[model samples]
Target: MRIAITRRGYITELDGVNKFIFNLAEGLNQLGCEVHIISHALGGSQVSNIASYAEKFFDFQGKFQIHALPFSYTNDALALPLWFLNGSRLINKLEVDAVIINGIVPLNSRKVKIAVNHGIFTGSFLNTNRITQHIYLQFAKHIYLYGIDLTVCVSSKLKEELGKLLNIKSIVIPLPLKLNLYRTEPLGKRSPLVLHVGGRSSKNAEISIQSMKILNEKYDLDVKLIIVGHKNAYLESLSAKYKYMVPKTLEFYFDASSLVVRDLMANAKALILPSRYEAFSYVVLEALASGLPVVVSSAIPSELVKDGFNGFRLLQYDPNLYAKRIKALLTDDDMWDGMSKNALKTARKYSHIKVAKLYLHAIQDIMRMKLNS
Candidate 1:
C-alpha cells in the first residue's frame, strides 16, 4: 500500500506534531507500506532561499520521498489553500492509496483522507481571544464532518469533544513515543525538586508554579522549581514577587536531539503538569517512561494517569493541594517507589512498535471499507 502524509509545518522542528509525523512515517515504512511526505516550505527570512529549504529536506532522513510545496504566504489561512493546490497536483502524479492530513484544513479530494485531532479549539481554556477561538472551533467542526473520511483523537477527552462537535464518535489513538530512547534509571534518593516541562504560556506551567508557592509557604519546604522551555516575561514577572517561596530556574527551548530531557526526568522527584487542556502530552509520557511519578491536572484523561496509583490528579487549580501532592511524592519513599514502578509499566503500552501496529490496522480497515463501498 502506498500512503501520502501531508503536513503544513517545518519538519526539522521538535514540536509534538512533527515528532508524531516522523515516528509514524518510519513505522509505516517498517510495516511494508510505501510512504511519502508532502510538506510546505517554511518561508521566513532565515529559510526563504531555495538552498535553505533544500537543506531542510536533506536533514529529514527517512525511507519515504518528500515533496515540498511552494507557498509564498506565511499565514496559515493563505498557505493552506496553496498547499492543497500543490498537493492535489502531486497526488494526481503518484498512485497513493490514502492521504493522512495532520491538521484541519479544507481539502476537496476523492481519495480517502484521515484527519488527526490533537486538540479541539474549545478545549484551550487559557486562550482569551474570542474571535480566533470561534474561527478555530468552526474549522474543527467542518473538517471533522466533511473534510475527512475518518478522524483520530489522541486522548479520550479530545475524542469526546470531537464527538460532540461532529455528532459522531472519533477513534481514540494515543500518541506514541520512542521508549527505547528514554531508559528507566534508578535515582536512589530524590531532592525536594519539582520539574515542569513546557513553554511558559502553557497552563500546565502556570499551575505548577502557583502550586509550588503554596507548598513552600505551608511546609516551609526548600524546593526548586525547574521549568524547561522558553521563558515568558509575564510569568517571569510573577515569579519575581515570590522570591522567598521556591527558587525558579528557566531553561530556554533546546534541541530534543540531546538526551538531556531523559536525564532530567530520571533525576527529578516528580513531574507536575498543571495544563488546563491537552490531547495527550509527550512530556508526561516521557516522564513515565523514565519511571518518574507525575502530578497532573484532572482535565487530562484518567487513562493516561491515575489519581493515586501512578500519578496524582489535581481536580482544580488549588495551589495548596497541588503542593501537598508534590511534597508527598518527594518525602515519602515507599509511595514514590510504588508510583514509579506503575508509571514505567503504564508507559510500556505506548511504545513505538505497538503504536505502529495499531495505526496499520486502522489504515487496513479504512482501505477495506473503501473497497467494499
Candidate 2:
C-alpha cells in the first residue's frame, strides 16, 4: 500500500517526535510498504534557535523519499496563508491510501488524516513562561482537529489529556522499537555504574543528582553515575560538588550519539530515569532491551517497566529511597542478574516489526471504515 506520513519539519533538529516519525517510516518501509514522508520547508523553534533546515540528512536509506513543502512554522503569521495556498495544494495531490500525521495537528488536506499525539508539550510550556506559551497556544488550537480522520495517542497518559484538550477519543499505541539494533552481548561483570538518560526539566535531573549524593553520604555506596544528554550550569555545579565529595562517582556525556549510548548502557549496572512527567520514554525501553535494570518514577507508563521485576518504580524523589534501590542491585549479584534477564523480556514485546504490521492494519482498518461511511 502507498502510505504518506507527515511531520512538522526538519529532522536535523532532533526531538522525541522526530525520532519516532523516522523510525516508523523506516519500519513501514522494511515491511515492504511504499512509504512517503512529507515535512515542512521552514522548521525549528524560536526558543531553541533551530531556525535553519535542509531537505537532506533525514535519510530513509532508499526505503522512501522525503518531500518538502511549506506546511510548518506553525507559530508564525505566515503559516495560515501558506496552508490555505501552498500546503493545501501539496497535500491534496498526494496519491496515497492513507495519510498519518505524526502529531496532534491538522493539515488542510483532503485525504483522511490520522493524527498521533505525542505529548502536551505546548501545555507544559506554561510551567516555564506564560506569555510565549500563550502566544503559541493561540495558533496551535486552531489546527488541532482540522481535517483529522483518526487520532492515535502514544500512551494512556497522553490519550487522557488529548480527550481534555480536543474533547475527542483516541486510540492508544505504545512507541515502536527497532530492538534488534540494540541487542548486545551481556556483560560478564558490570561496573557499579548507574546511567541517567535525560537532562531536561521533565527528566528531573536535579533529583537524580540528589539521590546519588544520598547514596554516597548516607549509605556509603561507592557507585558511579553516568549522565547522558544535555546539562546546564546547575547540573555542572552539582556534578563538581559531588566529585569533590566522592571522586570519579559522576560522569556526564553531552549530546551523545546512539553508539555512545549503547556502549554506556551495555556496561552500566542500571538505567535511572527520574522524570517528573512523561508520555512515553524511548530511552527507558531501549535501556531494558540492552539488559540493564531501570530505576524510574512510578508515573512512567507501567507497560514500559514493572516495579521490582525489570526495574524499581517509586513515586518519591527521596534520595535515600533511590540510593537504597540502587544499592540492592549492586550488593546482590543474583538479584541483578534476574532483573537484567526480565528487562530484556519486557523490551522484546515492542519490536518494530510487530509495531509496523499494526500500523498497516490500523490504517487499512480506518480507510475501510471511512469508505463504508
In order, the Cα lDDT scores of the candidates are 0.72, 0.71
Per-residue lDDT tens digits of candidate 1, residues 1-373? 8888887666544466766776677667777888887776555653445333323422223477777777653677787677667777787578787788886666657777888877765333235487876676676677777777888888888888777765766888778766776766554755566778776455556667777767766777767777676456745654565555443432333333336667778778888888877778877888898899999888668888999999898887777778889888877888989999999999988876677678778877887898898
Question: Candidate 1 — which residues are off by over 4 angstroms?
Answer: 43-64, 122-139, 187-192, 214-217, 231-258
Q: Which residue runs of candidate 2 sit more than 4 Å off their true CA positions?
A: 41-62, 71-84, 121-124, 127-146, 184-187, 231-247
Q: lDDT for model 1, on a 0 to 1 scale?
A: 0.72
Task: State every prediction's TM-score relative to the real structure.
Answer: 0.84, 0.85
RMSD of 1: 4.0
- How far in Å is the alpha carbon of 371 misplaced in model 1? 1.7
For model 2, where is the 10-residue window of minimal lDDT? 50-59
Candidate 1's TM-score: 0.84
